[model samples]
Target: MSPTIRSLVIPVTDLAAAKAVYTALLGAPHTDESYYVGYNVDGFEVSLNPSGDTAGPVAFADVDDLDAARESLLAAGATEQSAPRKVAPEARVCVLADGDGNPIGLRGR
Candidate 1:
C-alpha cells in the first residue's frame, strides 16, 4: 500500500462543471459539499476545491504521526507553509514547502 495520501486537491473555478468531469472519471464522491468534493478511488483520494487560488494541485501524504513527520521534514529543510488544521473528527492536515517552495501536505489523525 502507498504510505502517502495519494491525494490530490485541485483548485477549480467552476465547481459544478469540474465535479461533472471528475465524477465521470472517478464515479460518485463520498463527501460532496459546495466548497469541496472528495472521492476515494481504490484508496487514493482525489479532492476538489472551488477556491480561486489558481495555485494548481497539492498532494498530501498520509502519516501515522503528523507531529513526528512534520518535525522530520522540518529537520530535513522543509519550511512550514501552513499549520495543522483539523478537518474531520479523525483527521488533521498541514502543508510544508519543499526546497523549491512546492507545497507538500501531511495528513494524519
Candidate 2:
C-alpha cells in the first residue's frame, strides 16, 4: 500500500502484435486472454488491455481500502470515471479522473 503503483495497464490496438512486443521485452505473460495479457515482474503487474479509454498506459495505485480511498479522491475534487468493479476474487479496480482529465486507476479489495 502506502500509495504505491504496483499495477499498470497498457492500452494496445493489436493484441497479438502487442503481446509479441511485450513478451520480447518482459518475457512471457502469466495471464493471456483475448482481451488481456498480464505479466508479473517481481510482484509488479504489467497488463495490456485493448479496451482502455486512454491511449496511454494507466498506472493503478494499490490501496488498502478501495471505498475509503476512492471517496477521498472524490472529496478532493477528482471525478469518478468508472465505478468500483470486481476484477477477481477480493480484487477490484476503478478509474477516476483528475481536474485535468488524467485517468487515475485504483486496484485493491
Best by lDDT: 2
User: Which regions of candidate 1 are displaced past 4 Å?
Assistant: 52-54
Please provide TM-scores, in order, for all candidate models, with all chains considered together: 0.86, 0.92
lDDT of each: 0.88, 0.91
lDDT of 2 by residue, 1-109 (tens): 4978998999898889899999999999999999889999999999999786675888999899999999999999999888999989989999999999899999888
Which residue pairs does candidate 2 place in steric collision? Answer: none
| Residue 105 in candidate 1, Cα distance off native in Å | 1.0
Q: Write the per-residue lDDT of candidate 1 for residues 1-109, one digit (tens) a residue.
A: 3447679888899999999999999999999999889999988899998974537788989998889899999999999977988988998888899899998888997
Clashing pairs counted in every model: 1, 0
Residue-level lDDT for 64 in candidate 2: 94
> Candidate 2, after superposition: displacement of residue 68 in Å?
0.6
